[model samples]
Target: MSIWWSIHLRRDAASVPLARRLLLGTMETAGVDPDISYDLSVALSEACANAVEHGGDGDSAEAYRVTAYLDGEKCRIEVADSGPGFRPPSRPLPVRVASVEDEHGRGLFLIQALADHVHIGGKPGLGGTVVSFDKLLKWREDAPLIAV
Candidate 1:
């Protein structure tokens, strides 16, 4: 079975949970293993939070996109934003190690740690960024969606 979804969300704090909840509901209905579903949900939350915090101009000039695809035993997701885009030495051209005492800056790292594969890129100053990732899925024995 192949299932997919996408949502355009404003860079609002409340929008973060809304995206997460929808992803969770989709996974649950598909009978994804609870642990795997939880992991993906957390990753989705982090991605959405990043978008809410840094994906746009300070004003209400930006919104972000999140897309997810579940095919057979793999799940793929992508979060995109229209921002200043990534510039080297500033944005996450290369994900850095956030110190333990740091209150922020771990979102991308968390996404990398949770997913099987991750890719972060954008056209510098061209006004867009994309964080894409995928993971192998584990389904419950009673999963309604047959892994095709």
Candidate 2:
């Protein structure tokens, strides 16, 4: 079975958890393993949090979009924002921070570490940013499984 969903939300902090909760619910209903679902939920939270924090120019009407698709054993998600696009870093992303006290700059790093594949790009003709990622879904050996 294949499942997909898309939602556009105002660029606000509350929208972050809303997006994460929707994704988590969908994965859970699809029989995704708890651990995998948790990891993806956390990653989705980071992605949505980044959108809420950096995805607008103080315009309350601006919005971000989240899309998810589950096909076979893979789950793919895309988060697109309405803010000025940014060029992705050209070097390898660091997995750890230089200082424990640093409170920022870890979203992309966490997303990269959690997702099996990640793509960052500009929304075509929209003058904004899009972050897409995918993960291979795995089930525990003894768990009830849904045929994907």
Candidate 3:
């Protein structure tokens, strides 16, 4: 069985946990390993947090979209928002956000560390950034929705 879901959420701090809880519940019902579920949830939180923080510069978008797919033996997730798309440096150097006192920059790296595969890009017409990632799934022994 395959499971997929997508939701458009308000770009607010409260939306982060709402997305996490939904992901966690889906994983739990699907009998995904708890550890893997936790990892995915954490990644989702970071992605959602990023969307809330940058998805709208308080002028353009008021919401972000999050999508998840559980297919075969792997699970893929994506978070996208309508903002002034992410622009990378010419040389791709690590950037420090705002200042040393500001808590930022580590979220994307943490997502990369947690997920097996990660992709970052922008949606052209939407004028926003898209962060998508995937990881191999580990199932509980008695999982009802075990991937074939």
C-alpha lDDT values of all predictions: 0.83, 0.85, 0.88
Two-way lDDT contest, 1 vs 3, winner: 3
List the lowest-lDDT window of 10 residues for candidate 1: 86-95
lDDT of 3 by residue, 19-105 (tens): 999999999999999999999999999999999998888843498999999998999999999878877434433544456786777
lDDT of 1 by residue, 77-142 (tens): 888888766652343336576678998878877887788887787856567788888889998999
Kindly provide the TM-score of model 3 when superposed on the true structure, using C-alpha atoms. Answer: 0.88
In candidate 2, position 135 carries an lDDT of 95
Report the poorest 10 consecutive residues by lDDT, candidate 3.
88-97
TM-score of model 2 vs. true structure: 0.91
Q: What is the lDDT of candidate 3?
A: 0.88
* Model 1: residue 5 alpha-carbon error in angstroms: 1.0
Query: What's the TM-score of each model vs. the native?
Result: 0.87, 0.91, 0.88
Residue 18's lDDT in candidate 2: 94
**How do the residues 52-120 of candidate 2 rate in per-residue lDDT, one tens digit apiece?**
888889886789999999888989999999888899877657677558887878889889988898888
lDDT of 1 at 122: 85
Question: Highest lDDT among the candidates is held by which one?
Answer: 3
